[model samples]
Target: MSVLYHAVRTPVRWAFRLLTDLRVEGLHHVPSGGPFLLLPNHQSILDPLLIQSICPRKIHSMTKSTQFTQPAFRVVLAGLGAFPVRRYRVDPQTVRVLLRLLDEGQGVCVYPEGERSWDGALQPFRRGTLRVALRAGVPIIPVGISGTYDLMPRWLKRPRPGAPVSLRFGEPMCLGAIRDRSTRDRRLPEFERQLVREISRLASVPISRETRERLDAGSASPSGEGGS
Candidate 1:
């Protein structure tokens, strides 16, 4: 890890540990050193800080392109292992950066849900996010994060003090060759379910029927997954 990364993670982890009743499990599932994709469900704004800071490995994650508008923030985010992705558009440069980082044996994390859920339920993943996993030559780790939504949901601007939170990492999932995008689309619901089941179990969150229905709808529709 870079000195800058260490410098930031230490204090963030410290503050979180002090302020929140945090529980972390399945550390063994995280590769001690290697290129692996980390798929975490987005919960709170604190999710990234919680996952990356508590994680033993250095994790490079995607931040919104707008977050990098400020020059100082851009430098800070880059040092903290973040790159900007234009969420609403196809950004090839983001994919190049992701692939390049993985090629260098760095751990990369992307929230499968494009953004944090409003009601603590797992939201539908944006098209192109999962497709990245298909292209990467690495194992994918599904992470379940609970309680951050309770700490601070979309309705609240500030976190509640002394809320409990948990992070659970599951075993690796490796996908074989997908015949084509159409074939992949046919199998998309299963793939989404795989993540939902693993993450929800790991975090002890119940999979909602509505969430299942959304994935079902997604399977029949043509969509894209990229980290391409």
Candidate 2:
């Protein structure tokens, strides 16, 4: 980590710890070194910052590309090790950047759910996140967050102070085990199913077929109304 990153992250970390009474479980599951991807379920925007606070090592994260266009926010984001990701479309530039970061032994955070669930349920894993993992050649650490959405749900002005939050880190999964099989077009469906199953297990939340159907039909709430 750069001197500037530590300088900025330290204060933010302290603030989040104080504000949320954040509690983390399974920290031991995280590897001490990197060249790994952190895949967390997306329920609220606060997910990224909360993950950063609990993480033992620095994490490079993908933010909406629109965030970097603003001059003031751009400076703040850069200092905190965030990079831009175009939403709803696969931008090759963003993929290249993420792959390069992972190859260099850095940690990267990707939300496989694509967008936050409006009704506080886990959604299907987008195939794009898996693509990044396959190309990056890094192990994936599945992280599960609970209670953040309730603390600052969409349509709230500010997060309710003193809300309890939980973050759980699951065992690391090696991409190499499935890479060869997934490389063949015939095995794509099986690859995606297994990937989602692993993530769901790591999350430790039972997701029923009915719940998945509901979430897929639901729409995400507007951005900025909730904490990121």
Candidate 3:
């Protein structure tokens, strides 16, 4: 499945690169072996596609369960190595499936923010991601994406031509450093906070401390929470 995904992705990546002046940094940080998590800041719907394009490893992506309601869409998602995840609900079944994929040494891509940002700003990391990462005992690689929202914002039907996009792959974070059975619940929040901070540091555009605080506060609420 991964082999097929790579074959189909090559040309698509080139096309995106041609259309958008896409740039990537810190590719060397991705581990060559073992299970790992690619946790990126969600700016637009295109963010996931962009990450899949540049990553050398084939990533198992999680999509909204609603998208799978359509048979055709479900087939396409399955072919692309994506699985359905219920939004705003902690699905243990989905977590177990992801853990199995990790155990097989496959890479998984997750948006720690849980959803795309309406304003192209970084949002708070969701605890669900932290739960999976810690449970699977996989390293979390922080990724930062910039300018995708301008290209294809929620209000737009199609992407604007010639928009700039940048992706930065931060250093891989060791799960061992964050693991603590005694304070597992508390650790997720702190881990997510640190993850967002790392992503913000790598973004092409700078984010203000005040804005980060606002995003974190907003994410604490149930509303506007996105699927995996």
Deviation from native of the Cα of residue 36 in model 3, angstroms: 0.5
Rank list by lDDT: 1, 3, 2
Candidate 1, 104-168: lDDT as tens digits: 99899988777778778776665577666766658889999998988988788999969898888
* Superposed model 1: Cα runs more than 4 Å off: 176-183, 206-210, 218-228
lDDT of 3 by residue, 5-26 (tens): 7777888799788999888899
If scored against the real structure, what TM-score would every candidate get?
A: 0.90, 0.81, 0.86
Q: Report the C-alpha lDDT of model 2 over 92-169, residue by residue, as the tens digit.
A: 777778878877889988887767767666676655666556555677778887777777765566788677777888
Query: What local lDDT does model 3 show for residue 35?
Result: 80
- Model 2 reaches what TM-score against the true structure? 0.81
Write down the lDDT of every candidate, Cα atoms only.
Answer: 0.81, 0.69, 0.74
Worst ten in a row by lDDT for model 2: 219-228
Indicate the worst ten consecutive residues by lDDT in candidate 1.
219-228
